[model samples]
Target: MKKLLMFVCLSGFAGFPSTAVAAPVVVGLADGLAGNRFPWSTTGGMRWQQVFSAAELTGFVGQNLDQIAYQTVQGATGYTISSLVISVSTSNNAPGSLSSIFANNIGSDNTVVFNQANVTVGANSSSGGFDFALPFTTPFLYTGGDLLIDVLAGGSSSAATFFRANGSAVTTERVYSSQGSPGDAGGTATSNGTLVTQLNFTAAGAPELHPGGAVLPLTFAALSCLIFSRRRRISY
Candidate 1:
């Protein structure tokens, strides 16, 4: 929310001071091709989520994350991600391997930022790269700790989204599935790699209120059993 101040001469009252929002701050890998084919629709659809640690989000302590964008190395128009839903949360999980239990990954205030039945994301013609930028309906406030982004979409898709990513971005972990639907239990937890995420925030940080409960899609229920593996841990 933008701040405004007004003064009235009739009452000889001077308006209180107001503060302007700061410029947006973006953090994450900018470009790389070693990523999954799509954050969009992949065969059998997909579910994707990545957590960013507090150290990486240093400057965004009080910021309101209003938008998130994904960069694709190869993409085109006409392709659509069906049953798309993008959600965010302050995760108890960190940059390392995500929990096999889904709820263990989510912290306080799970909120859905974007949801669309079907939509086409355009390519950035000038840059020769395509970007799928989704604005949050309810901008998430980054109070502190690790930030988690959960992306899910169902249905078969022909176009390959091929989002840019880096293996060297900080310790990373993601839960993903190729055999995903809009209403699946959960995906396999991978203890490596993360999408090069782009986060946009209100400079002054929106004065957001904290909610008591979470509004998440993949709530309680353990993920399909899989072999456990060693995970990299983000320092406390």
Candidate 2:
């Protein structure tokens, strides 16, 4: 009987059959994000349509979303992605796919290469809408700087309807007509119109901070406490 008691007590000190503890730490999250559509200040019929661009990003300060809010808690950048409303004012113009929306990494050649996941578009001038949270094939990080969202016309026109980029030194450049070559393919509109948007990035989360990770150190601490208690009892 005494030997069995010793074994039981030894097991407890060995940190086996651990006790489950309640977790009470609640962390806040970032605001949900949605793309905003703004009308160009100028609207008129010209030989080549003039691309309207969003104003230079005046603020890195973020706006609020009703459905979901984006926040930074415990160093992790929280994202609340959802559907967004959009609109295009041109006669036959419309909002296209977001597949092209990606992280443009500056290359060694001093150019940009956008890397991201495939995307789809279904919104129109009448009732603009978009679905966010499509799985990202190439999720890029925005350390800081300009980010452009270009709307391209499918082989339909040599000119682009619009093009927009957001970040510091925000400037809206609209080209009503194509300067020359057909320009790159895809949804990026050469002259459709572009809007300048603004954004700021928070630090990304580290692997160690994930949940279920606090156990290791906590277990060690608990084991130490138990050993101390056993030693005191033995001394007595």
Candidate 3:
């Protein structure tokens, strides 16, 4: 009877799934200077429509933009991750097109990479790149806040000028063809034109999803049965 019972238990172990076999999935959230809300959508292959200007983005650094708007993994267990990459793109236009990037710790009042990069637009065809590696001590975990990008300035001497916030400069230079006429500079070559840009957040590796309390309870019940059966044979 003891040998028979042992055989049954070992068979059950073979049937059960191993906890070590599951892989995790990761999710990330991104925010702009403006309060467009969390879980911002991505469309047009890689273009994001909800870009924020510099002034609209000032108070949000080092805080979770999720308090306003954020994104999440569809189904995943919260766990420590290896690293996260945040990307910022500046306009690739000629002049007045630049994107300045910044980051701050969530909850604490410190700059991660304050004004980290001032990108040129036309250098990358309406876009540039900014990536940050998670600091070893920080581990880069999101609370309902933190992680965001802002547009500090934008415009062109030959293009329309617009400020994301206060203290921005916009020049009215007509350089279509260097014509003396104000509106008819169509023949002049434009100068100092600035284009708008975007920011994004991505994570590396997989995240584990919580199986929920119900599944755990069922697993416990089965484990208990196995233990009880083994005890009965040993007692005899």
Candidate 4:
């Protein structure tokens, strides 16, 4: 009976530890370009078109996505960033028709992890850009893949929004134009060799356990229990 009790206890204690207090891991992509100017501000007609860029997230396969950070620039009149949307997909290419890449058009394959209409980034004092962080109300599990973040400014023509530019010879970033509505279809997305944007995010989870490590704890517990049982029998 004692051996059976020991076996039950060992089985229950062999599972992965809870990650209640694990520190969040920060992941980011920097815009290597030197300029502070906003790209794609003038390309998407006067309607609401957004630039699309993605960063490959490694080591964050099973973490929970917490927040996203982005940089933007404002015009003379200043701009308000009322909405921010983020989507995730395994594919590097934009999903759906080239003309539109809205949340719905991407189909069920994509997950919109963050959606908010009241996001605000105050006006800039100069042409230089500023950075802001948007926290997710409900975090989502990051199944280890690339993240695509879309910044929208309510389709206002008076104000200009900018994403940090990457000067790399080649990039995964693409630009597309939408009618400014979440449901509206967008124009074909294109990538210019000179322009790309930066992206960053935070995730929270315990470090993954290796196979050997997982087995070590259970083995130790079973051995200790066996020793205790043998000692008790000898004393009796």
Candidate 5:
């Protein structure tokens, strides 16, 4: 019993069982060529939805989804979004299959992660990098499976944001509107294109503070161990 107690105490001290804070993690296609931009202000389009298969987003299972990041192409230096709403959800579909109907392709947990005005997106010096981001207002708890990204914006930029593409793997699908300020659900489905994008997530129930935050993990671990040792000594 005493040995077991010590083991348990030490485990806490050593940050066992994944209780430590989960660092912000990103998952997506590696850097690649320009794909396309959203609500291209130049054409007056308003909304878009990017779909990614469960195979691509499997890493997000059991995590709290927080941010959706975009990359800019080499041609344009900056992209400005006047009013934007970013939403995300999940689905259960094969990597190569997608329906032209937006409603036919999503789960019920669609969440508006970001809604802001007048946001400026910066450019990547090279082909494209995950530099533009919309920090979610509330982290979406991803239960696992396919992921969907819905974007609606009321702004414009001369340059475009590109995504990494895999012509061989049709794991991503997209839908967007060509008219200005289309309703959230109004958009024409386009040919399949795997977008190179980045998504960030936070682990749920993490007890440790961020690196510089007030309480350190070791502090609690040491205190717990000390208390346990003292109790054992008294019983003896």
Candidate 6:
């Protein structure tokens, strides 16, 4: 009877689920610095409209992407960020055009969309810039080697907001500018040799188990059955 009870206790303890703790992951062109250049959208007047930036993640595939944070500079007139689109592709080359990124399935297979209802920024004169967190409705799983982050701002207005660019510069990634309207995808060129934007994101590290879920209940049930059987045997 004592051995049976010990066995039951050991089984119950072993079946307990472990706590799942995910680690944070950040990917960007460079660390933000003071007095960084603010790159604005191209569609709005003199300022550029859409800036397409790409980066290669060092982590393995299948990591859960949680939130994306980018540095921005507010202009005289407050601007609203319309949406943020993230696409993953195997190819390292830049997409032919912004519109083509969505339509083409050649390299990009996974696309996550985040629509901004009122992601606005107030005017700020500070050169340190402001970091904005744009959380995804659902976490996206990393599938490809390269990530293309497309930020759309100035929804239906000429008012401008600027995204801070990498001052230290990066060679692996390039920034593309579109002179025409959003989704136009025409007359695109590399704006700077190594002037990529500063951005970061959080991703899940290792997976963990939990208690009181499916496994725990089954373990308790088996343990109860074993205890009951042992009790009956001892009584007889």
Query: Any runs in candidate 4 off by more than 4 Å, and if so which?
Result: 1-31, 34-55, 73-78, 82-85, 92-109, 123-130, 150-153, 156-158, 168-171, 178-184, 193-236
* Number of the top lDDT candidate: 5
How far residue 132's Cα lies from its native spot in candidate 3, in Å, is: 20
Question: Candidate 4 — worst ten consecutive residues by lDDT sum?
Answer: 43-52
Instruction: Name the Cα RMSD for model 1.
Output: 19.4
Residue 93 lDDT, candidate 4, scale 0-100: 45
What lDDT does candidate 6 reach at residue 156? 28
Q: How much is the lDDT of residue 35 in candidate 2?
A: 20
lDDT of 5 by residue, 91-138 (tens): 554344556556666679988888888777666636445666677887
Off by over 4 Å in 1: 1-33, 124-130, 191-193, 203-236
Lowest-sum lDDT 10-residue window in model 2:
64-73
RMSD of 6: 7.6
Model 4: per-residue Cα lDDT over 15-34, one tens digit each = 64743333343323334443
Q: Could you tell me how far off, in angstroms, the CA of residue 224 lies in candidate 4 after the best superposition? A: 33
Instruction: Give the winner by lDDT: 2 or 4.
Output: 4
lDDT of 6 by residue, 1-236 (tens): 66776687677667655544444444444544423222233343112222232344555455666555555554444655444344433444443332334233224454444555546554554664335555666565666455555444334243444555544434333333343344543323332332333333334543344354567676667778777877878897
Ranking by lDDT: 5, 1, 6, 4, 3, 2
lDDT of 2 by residue, 177-196 (tens): 23222232322323223322
The C-alpha RMSD in Å for every predicted model, in order, reads 19.4, 15.5, 16.9, 9.3, 5.6, 7.6
Worst 10 residues of 6 by lDDT: 44-53
TM-score between model 6 and native: 0.53
| Residue range with the least summed lDDT across 10 consecutive positions in model 5 | 25-34
TM-score of 3: 0.22
Candidate number with the higher TM-score (2 or 3) = 2
- Judged by whole-model lDDT over C-alpha atoms, candidate 5 comes out at 0.63
Better of 1 and 2 by lDDT: 1
- Model 4: number of backbone collisions: 2
For candidate 1, write residues 1-236 as lDDT tens digits.
01111122212222212333533444445334376664474666667777877877788777788878766666555576667788889888776657855667887799988888876666533573336778788887778888888877666355555666765555456777555453455666764446776777774433432242221311211111111111112221
Overall lDDT per candidate, in order of appearance: 0.62, 0.26, 0.26, 0.45, 0.63, 0.46
